[model samples]
Target: MTPRSVPHPRGVRLVEGGADVAVYTESAEAVEFCRFDSDGNEHRTRLDQRTGHTFHGFVPDVEVGTRYGLRVHGPWDPANGLRFNPNKLLLDPYATAVEGGYDWGQPVFGHDMNNPDQLDESDSAGSVPRCVVTDRHSFDWGDDRPPRTPLAETIVYETHVKGFTQRFPGIDESLRGTYAGLAQPAAIEYLTDLGVTAVELLPVHQFVQDSHLGEKGLRNYWGYNSIGFLAPHNEYAAGGDGGQQVDEFKALVKALHAAGLEVILDVVYNHTAEGNHMGPTLALKGIDNASYYRLVPDDRAHYFDTTGTGNSLNVGHPAALTLIMDSLRYWVTEMHVDGFRFDLATTLTRQGGDADVHSAFLDLVAQDPTLAPIKMIAEPWDTAGYQVGGFPAEWSEWNGKFRDDVRDFWRSADSVLGTVSQRILGSPDVYEPTRRSPLCSVNFITAHDGFTLADLTSYDQKHNEANGEDNNDGESDNRSSNNGAEGPTDDPEINDRRNRQRRNFLATLLLSAGVPMILGGDEMGRTQGGNNNAYCQDDEISWFDWDAADQGLQEFTRMLIRLRRREPALRPEWYRRGPRDRSTPDRVQILRSDAKGFDPPDWNNPTARTITFVFHHDDADSFALLLNAAENGVEFTVPKAPGQEWRLELSSDDAQRVEGKVTTLILEGRSFTLLRSVTRKDVRGWARAHGYEVSSKGKVPRQVQQAFDDAHR
Candidate 1:
């Protein structure tokens, strides 16, 4: 039958009697759509229709669940970046469902192993995975709506799908470590109870496991090496991955939204699983290598890799941009995801080997109506450069400075007072010049990349020897401290210090003015046994241990989250300067331990370890936060309020003591204390009527307290 011309839709779409298949390639001389039967028989048909650069055709009897692959025949010139071998069977770039894994041998590579310039004629049909045709709009999204939590109120929980539920006690053993496991009632209830507004899952895009790690008997647990952009990782689906993984992922999103939780995906679009020149011809490389990847201007044989990955996507080209945009829209419209957090996002903005604010990729995302309202977050850096506040005003960023400053402050590093204050105030110094609100900073102390919260407070050095990199795979300057002991210790003082430090970090993160993201297992004291980089260890080192959870720390984290949710003054929508006058009511005051406003010189003082923040909101109760990072306890003079007395709400130190109507309190070293202002009119009136001689501006004496209690009794 003569193939019909269909160039609009890029992927295979279900029609009445058949399927419409389209693949975009600018350099291919001929493209063939190949299908495999249940018995592994190959039937090939040429995509004879071509409009501009897109090659498309219609298959008469193609149905959903059909396994298919693409084969592009073109020039094999390597020096000018045209690598096309018809021997390789490539997965569809827009495949919604991918089946099987790579065999990871010489057959998968397009070039000869010994000679780089020569093409290998070995067929890769048995080595690479096949794309499964799926009905994109077949999932029943009954009355499902995205939570769309506002940026200011968002509390992000960065978690791994398999690691989060692999050992969860509430879910079934079969469903554990799958997409179905996270959608279960147990996982949903736990998140709702913890009060986080969104769950920022790590990469779920279909990826390739590294062959090197396979040789070491390890797996790529992080899921960063993506091969299929529109498909969910087959290993994460509980159901078989012929096409059921699509519906299962959609159900997971629906279940999360029903529970008032937003699902934010940590997407990887900067690079693909295919490495440099020596890498496999998985999908795009076999389709159109010159158009899809950024190659060196003079040396087209080499790739311009800014992502630390072997090759970066050529976002400047129209072909690559279209693929990325299509994949993003498919996730939002078809898959029902709420937002995205781009990994190594800076690499996407490099149009000419330098990060540009006006790049075509950012421009496309800014003006696209479907993506305008979606919460777009950028990792904001790559292996090349760090662009913390470099994105547009409409986007938020993972604030690396916030993490470093908060860690340094808690560790009592000198000259960090100024930066820590800036971090606590939503990083105005970073975002203010860009005219962006405080919500633009996604403040997080720990994430999937670095040390877990428990490990951060227990080890000063990274224990990444398990990563098979000779203890050099992770970051050396972790900004972490072991307090007193290196590993587990019997010393009660050291353990107590470590526990207090954990609370300190959590309190700082939740109470700070920005969008806070808590590492998933951090609340329950999940330790990696000092392994800061456990990307390869998918077992106990990375999984959450429910049996050994720290219930006390969990309760403390819950309390902090509840407090953050309850207090409006804790999270401001925008950066606010001090009130014009005292009566303005909505303001923030940074005061020293002596209850005096900080001067320019005081902020520069390296010895200044004690600081206080007084947050005054117009509609909520005023709050005062006291932080002491000194080696010894410091007595803080409470700021005088005319008709209000400070009531102790929460403290990181369990042994902290506070009496009624406190005029002065000694905060323990490396501890945080929160106090709310309570009106003392009733008590003061009672004291005055009983002739207790209570002063209007000073502390109410113990005699008056006793008399008031006695009279009330």
Candidate 2:
């Protein structure tokens, strides 16, 4: 009987009585399909089927649990970027699920370390992980649908799947640090109650732990070093026995969707785990090194590294481009993901060794039907270059400018008020020309890479001594203030100031115009002991400290998110400027401390520290935000509303609500105030309910007002 074959869908697809496997390799002289038995016995079978640059074969009685790998026999010349060694078993680039762990002790490199000119003769089959054939249709995804939360309404919570739940007391011990743990009822409830529409999970792809980090007894806690693009990390699956990782991941997605929360994956398409020329022979490097990686024109042996990862993926090549798109589509269609956040996304847009706005990769992604609609976010810059505010209109960018300016403003850096104002208004200075909405800026104060929110307030210097690089591995210039004391302090005043600063950061992020992304564990005041870069610390250093969480801060963060959701003036869909319309009070006006009007001198004043953001909404109710960044308390005259009176809604200083017309309000230095304006009827009712003698038009008697003010003070 003739062997059946297909070339369109490239992975190992299970059929009625057999499996159809297809792989692409442009430079392979011969491609051999290898199978592993229960006892790890190798069975070699030559692929007789062939299409243009793709090898397809149909094997009979290929069971679902079959473990397999591919061997590409090609040139051994590394100088010309043709590194193909059949001795080292290569993982299937399109493997949906991978089995076993890679051992770094074994010779996994194509070229011998002792002799770089000679090929490595050692067989790496035992050390290398094999791809497991899985039944894609096995998981019963009953009524699982992406939340499809509007971008304008999205509140992203960036978290690591393992680090998020590794020490979670609410989850079962057996399921901790796994996908199941993240989908636990307790976890879902926490996220849902926090009012975040989506959870942007750190990479869950099957990645290779760095050999050097392993030697140092530290692992890659952050899953950025990926080897298998299409496979879920089996180590993250609670039920690891048999090929249940795929299903476990699917179930996690299903559970998140069921709870009305979207899952956005932080995908690393910029580079692979395979390091430079001396790197191990994994999947892409071993199969087709030159085609998959961006090689140096002068020296093909070396790679053009843009991600600070040894080798960058050549998105300029069609094969590599298709693989990225295929993997993304697989996650969306098969695994049921809502969106993606591209790591080192600027590297993917490089064409001719320069980042381009209209690069081939971006154009392809914009044109692709499967990917255009989903939420796409870009880290927007690579290690080589900074491309903030440089992404296209279709995508949202992680606003590095917003992060820096917010940190600087809170740290009392001079000349930052203007920049912070621009950032809070969704960075119209950056995205206005593109005609993108405020959602184009993904505003975040702290992210996974830098210091956690708690640490940002506690440490001014990075203490990465445990990472074994003499405190040189992480970033310097942390843009943080220790508030008169380094690390934890016993002084009550210092601690209070630190806590207030943290609240200020959270309020600023959540109350900003663009989409807000809270770093996981920040709400609970999780700290990394000043280790800003804890990428290699897989132990307690990186895990979420559930035992020592600040419950007050958590509740405060929840309240902030709730307020952001409740107030439309906080999360405006469009960029707020002069006014939307005169008929309805749809205007965003910036006023001086006197609340008169915007003056050039007042805005240009270098010593100025207070401004009022009056958000005149279409509804009768409006919001007046007063931000005071001075060291001394400032008196801000409330901006006159057309027909409504200002009522104290919320204050970062923990001030009590004092309703009625707020002619002049006192805002503490380095504090924020949120006031809501109410109508005549509501003000009168509030005044009456508070035991104040109110006139017919809601104006309280002079003595009654004085009593209320004294009581609040």
What TM-score does each of the candidates earn? 0.94, 0.94
Could you tell me how far off, in angstroms, the CA of residue 425 lies in candidate 1 after the best superposition? 0.2
Instruction: Please give the distance, in angstroms, between residue 191's alpha carbon in candidate 1 and its true position after superposition.
Output: 0.6
C-alpha RMSD of candidate 1:
4.2
Best by lDDT: 1
Off by over 4 Å in 1: 1-3, 577-586, 679-713
Q: How many clashes show up in model 2?
A: 0
TM-score of 1: 0.94
lDDT of 1 at 449: 88
